[model samples]
Target: MADTQTYKFNVGMTCGGCSNAVNRALTKLDGVSKVDISLETQIVEVQATIPQADVLEAIKKTGKPVTPL
Candidate 1:
């Protein structure tokens, strides 16, 4: 089995809608086991076995700027 990894991203999320958008986008990607977003902190946490680049691209598709932290 692939190792599970946790990735933290700083995303510009304004509300629940923004966080939900990010969550939806990320959940569509293969190997993404879970997603956790904190609107208050504007942070997105992902648990997955996928590559970081792939995850970044998925988040970008949500139309939000994301930075690795």
Candidate 2:
């Protein structure tokens, strides 16, 4: 099995809807195993076997600016 990696991202989420959208987009990815989002902090943490680029792209699809941390 592929090693799981933890990726943190700075997502510009102003509301619950924004965070939820990011969460849904990330969770739908095949290699993503878990997702944790904090709207207050505007951060999203993802546990996945996929590449970090893939995770970043997933979050981007939500139409929010994402900065990988």
| Global lDDT scores for all candidate models | 0.93, 0.93
TM-score of 1: 0.95
lDDT per residue (tens digit) for residues 1-69 in model 1: 899899999999998899999999999899999999999999899999988888999999999999998
- For model 2, state the Cα shift of residue 43 in Å: 0.8
lDDT of 2 at 28: 89
**Deviation of model 2 at 48, angstroms:** 0.2
RMSD to the hidden true structure, all candidates: 0.7, 0.5
